[model samples]
Target: MINLHWIILLPIIFGTVVKLLPLKTAKKLMVLFQAVLLVLVFVIFIEVRKNGTILENIGGWPDTISITLRADLLASAMALLTCLLFLAMLTFVQNKHYADHLFFFLFLSLESLIIGIFLSNDLFNIFVLIEAATLIITILIMYKKTNLSIYDGMMYFLINVVAMSFFLMGLGMLYKKIGVLDFYALETALSQVKDPDSMILPYAFMITAVSLKAALMPLFSWLPKAHGTPSAPSEVSAILSGLYVKTGVYLFIRLQLAFSPLINTSELFMVLGFITAIVGFVLAFAQTDIKLLLAYSTVSQIGLIMVGINMGSPQAYWGGLYHIMNHAVFKSTLFLTAGMIITEYKTRNLDEIKGVFNLMPAVGMATVISILGIVGAPLFNGSISKYLISEGSSGSWIEYGLIFINLGTIIVFIKYGQLLFGESGKKETANSDILEKAVVLGLSMLCFFGGIFGSELISILFEVNFPVEILSHGVKLLLFVGSLFLGLVIYYGLFKKKNYLAVLNAIELGFNEICLSITLFFAFMVIYLKITL
Candidate 1:
């Protein structure tokens, strides 16, 4: 029923209506509503698993005229990941210093838009929801009022809105050609077209726009700046890095599914993904600020996910999706732990900070587990995803590329380990100790145990046969040893020297801007050729 759509609207509507209420009460109510929404997402996840897909058409209109909400396997997986990330964020922010009501409102609004993005079966609807998300996130970025926050927020707004414009134009062109905006309709129309190349304009445009949103390669400049700026409330950063960026990835996947025949080059995605991964880690390794390091790490992780999808094998698709979920959980945990650390120490600089583990052992343990998960240590979620991704890669070159990315991930996390557990001389207190320990313990358990059971979880969730070869014991041991060795090499060779960081930073900044411009130019050229040729 259309009422299902109302579930998303509940928090937004209530938050707006209660704007004048006491901020504390409003915040509590919003959190309560989000909990209900989380439950609803689980219900939908179960129902979709049982029924194949769930579709809701607004106002009793048929699928063609009404907006449609549908949940496929991919959508359900994303939704579940989102809910979990939201739960972590809520927990992390329970006693934080931010404006509770505004924070909750923004959080719910972002979640609603994300859910809308996943649920919508129509291209136009996806565009609208993405726009909504952009606006809400922009406000969230600007909420801090710092120079960096405002500047980065503006950059994010400008770039994404520009991309959204391209999306709208592409949708308009498709609608004009096919007289419909639904995925099925557009697919049908494109399938019947004699010149598939003609559709490249829209495809390029849409992909470019979504890539910017996803922080893939060149369009990623705004990400590190924005994400690193506001102190991002830990859990919010987790969601931003964890699930928000995946919106673009999901859109790209949906596009590929609907228009695979029209797409000529999967190599572009593969190559770009590889570049992003390498560049992201290089920059992350250079960052003195811990938040920036994690932010750049996101860029690298996303690249790995994209490369998995670009491989175009069933194994890769499953792996990509699995990685998406895995990244969300562990990444959120990492960010939350980072937040707790920063809150206690009141700094983001890694060099100045000393042995925090001494102050907060629980958080220290959690941080270690999260770093292990990110670096693909054995029996963690990262290993599962990394194995699948590597297995899905076709040529030796791509496999080697994957290996390099893995090495970079290992190296960056080694630096993270140094900062998290190294030499902070801060003293631990009785009160801060308990809270920090609790949060760390919970997240660490998830990172370590969750990885061990990830295969079983994926099998049950997707109702598909997960390949045993990819998850074999030998492969796990190899990855563990290889990654550990790589970490040690980087730690002794590069991080200890501390000379490559500046070079890596400059390269990342330059590469991101260049890629963004080139992609946008390519899209524009395609559109021009379509019009004039």
Candidate 2:
């Protein structure tokens, strides 16, 4: 029987063909194709749930040149989230002014690469898929034909290609030692190897490369610039912040599991995650542009996810994975909504765009839900994972660090809430269409219900004790009251003061670059140790 791996490539192939079709017909065909793809994904999700871990070896090749596609619990959950987000984005972009054929082609190509990354079992194949995704994303970023978009795309391409080169070098080292590229085979080889010395170089290189790709601080400078730019489509922002970055996290988890014995390096991950979380939010709080604020917030959220995974408990792992799904939903929704607001208001500045909620209730409501989710407010999907991550942690320092970051998240979103609700008198509502409203409503519903029943849903998917008590009663109330107060204080007191915009610009350009250089130096130290020790 043929495997579902082949099915993963269908969208890409179809998307390319669609791009070649007449522009008038392309939009209709793209929507129809994406709708069908969504249905197929749902069917695949069902099949995977019924039968544990679907794996297919291509061309009957068991050991060499075998392309393996497998869906574990994590992969299925991610795929589901991706498909849903993609659908919402499609709806939003369907009516917007753009080359419909090219846009859909790039979008589907991105989807194909993401699926390929998630489902593949070979390290080499994962690298290839990641490169493919990056190339497609670069094209998407530059698709708008603006100077800012072109510059951002070039920067993104250069940085990511460098990162991938390091990853390829690491893969080469691993292949030299093990003679196999499959993750399972590499795991077996590492377990069988006697000397730990030979393993350290490849391991360190791989981890660093993954960290860079994932946008862990201080390697996160490129992200805010690349993701914060206005030239890319809103849907592309969703994919970049939502699904694409998570690929690195997934690889980290898989590798950590495979090399559990040789690699007891969670402490490094913990420290890096803590710093990243703190820095991310601090930077986020300083941004004037709403999209940049949200982009930095993504950095902070990704940091929190890493903290959960680095905690090294099964509960932490589960929470990390759960948060991945929740973050994707909320973050993508928020970005899309932001795009809608920008499209309507003709401005990305929060100060100029007053009384937005009064103008677009649907968009406002969606933004409110997404903000609450990010803040870990009660009965929301984000709170469940946040609670799990915090309580699942054993160390006091780590737990407290997470709490402080959560507080900072509250502060950042509080500014957003203030911008939405506080500055109400200014008129001038930008015109918006029906499709935009539909997109916002669709995502809002997901975040709302996803929060309300997160525990039950995750429990069924994970087949573990979902810890409803902490999620329902404890963290929700604490975060709500705490964040609300912090937000009020920060907005009313601090942010209302002088020209912090210059400071924010400096941080975005100067400080972040310094941090990135420092991180690269540390990575080099690890390489040096591998060579010497």
Candidate 3:
């Protein structure tokens, strides 16, 4: 019988073998390895669908005592995403010099850790997986060995280490209070608690850690540095922006669900999510470097996802989950194509690059499709999820907030959309990498099909039916068109002539400031919980 543990174990075991093999041999072997791993993930996903949820206790110990691996619909979906992205990224970079044995080892090792995180039902086990993943990512960030890269890596490492300490402390407190680290067990115990106050401190601690991981509002300072660092490979950036950072959001969902009985702070997160969304777009519009633009955009989209998740309705909550998948596909494509553009043009500045459609049609087409998807164009994946979130938030200020956020997204992308048009002043079309182009095109197609069949996909993915009515869909389409027109005018009329956004981008938070922000965030959460509960 195929087991969940093998899904986590195969990568590590094979990665070791690949690491010791000759470079050429290892390169070919790793592809096959990823293919096999993808199959395993598919099998597990199928099993999860057949059964409600799969549960296993290591060494046959009782569920409350042993490490637990649980694969429900949510976990299975996320695990499938993990496998698919790792395979895409690995394949995307196969022909590059960077796809060496050690790199492959670290990549697959990170994959194993992330999948472990998705499957683990024990709180301590999840923490350990997160910590291990962090270490692997640090190495990957500084893989190129530059001063700037090293600085980015160390800052990422140090800040995350400090943040995860809080997670560990919270876990210690929870284990002490509940006598078990299993998620289900903890939930049962928490439901029996008479006072919500007792869990506040630990909740604050663990949530602070997760918020940082999720790049929520003030805790997101480390994200751009880690994701947009020029020294890192494009595939690394793609995975980081596309999937890795999402682990934080995923954890936030899991932890919040586990703590739902004792804590209810949806209002607080909703506010923060809105702010993060606004700030993310403003920064993205100001960026000259291509990667930083995408990085800040990730921050903005994550904030939007957070907003949807906390909208206090099933439609919006599941919409938020669906957006996670949408963002993963679109953002991954953007990053991958950006890498190709940067390589072809030898410039990361947006001003110097143009006529991508004329020079590289395949890549240009992919970029255009992804940009459309992200802007929530009427027939794109983003539109479907955004509409669902709006539907859930209908008849309130939250609805208006969603509109403004979408407008801001349009404005930011309008600036980026320039890359697809105009003349590059070059005569020859650049040779394309077939594999890379294929991957990019495939993901871009997903962005379109995901939107076209959004309702059906949501139903299939989550086993829930919340169909989009035609009248409502038409209204959203009108709203999207209005937003797009306004965004274009704002981008061309005001932003094109002025550099005000550049000033906004100049504001950078240092390490000390980030730590201070973390402290303030925790304090605010604690105080809010005390009053609200």
The sequence of per-residue lDDT tens digits that candidate 3 reaches over residues 183-250 is 89888989999989999999999999999999999899899999999888999889989998889999
User: What tens-digit string does per-residue lDDT give for candidate 2 at 1-533?
Assistant: 33577557887898878767787677777767778777787677777777877888888898546987778777877776777777777777877788577778788878888888888888999999998888888889888989989888888887778777777887899889888887777778778878877777677778777887788877888887678888788888878997788988999888887767565677778778888888898888888788888999999999999998888777777788888988888888888888888877778887677666787778888899888888888778887788788777746688778778998898788776655664555475546778878877777777778778887777767767765674445655865697678768866787666536437567444444634663574567476556554
**Inter-residue clash pairs, candidate 1:** 218-516, 354-423, 354-424, 355-423, 355-424
Instruction: Give Cα-based local distance difference scores for all models.
Output: 0.75, 0.79, 0.90
Stretches of candidate 1 off by over 4 Å are 1-3, 17-21, 433-440, 467-471, 506-533
Higher TM-score: candidate 1 or 3?
Answer: 3
Which pairs of residues collide in model 3?
A: none
Considering every candidate listed, which one attains the maximal TM-score? Answer: 3
The segments of candidate 3 whose C-alpha lies over 4 angstroms from its true place after superposition are none
What is the model-wide C-alpha lDDT for candidate 1? 0.75
**Which stretches of model 2 miss by more than 4 angstroms?**
20-24, 422-430, 470-472, 499-502, 508-533
lDDT of 1 by residue, 1-533 (tens): 22558756765776676688887676566567667777887887777777787777888897778988778777877876776666556655666677667777788778778877887899998998888888888788878677767777777777778778888878887777678887776677777888866677777777778778778776777788667775456666777887888888899888877776565456677778889999899889888788889999999999999888888777777787888887887777777777777877788877776676777667777888888888888778787778777777746688888878888888888777876556566444414545335655676677776578877877867776665465464865786697678779868975677645666566534335644684665666476546543
Identify the superior model by TM-score, candidate 2 or candidate 3.
Answer: 3
Q: How large an RMSD does model 3 have?
A: 1.1
Q: Give the Cα error of residue 260 in candidate 1, in Å.
A: 1.5
lDDT for residue 478 in candidate 3, whole number 0-100: 91
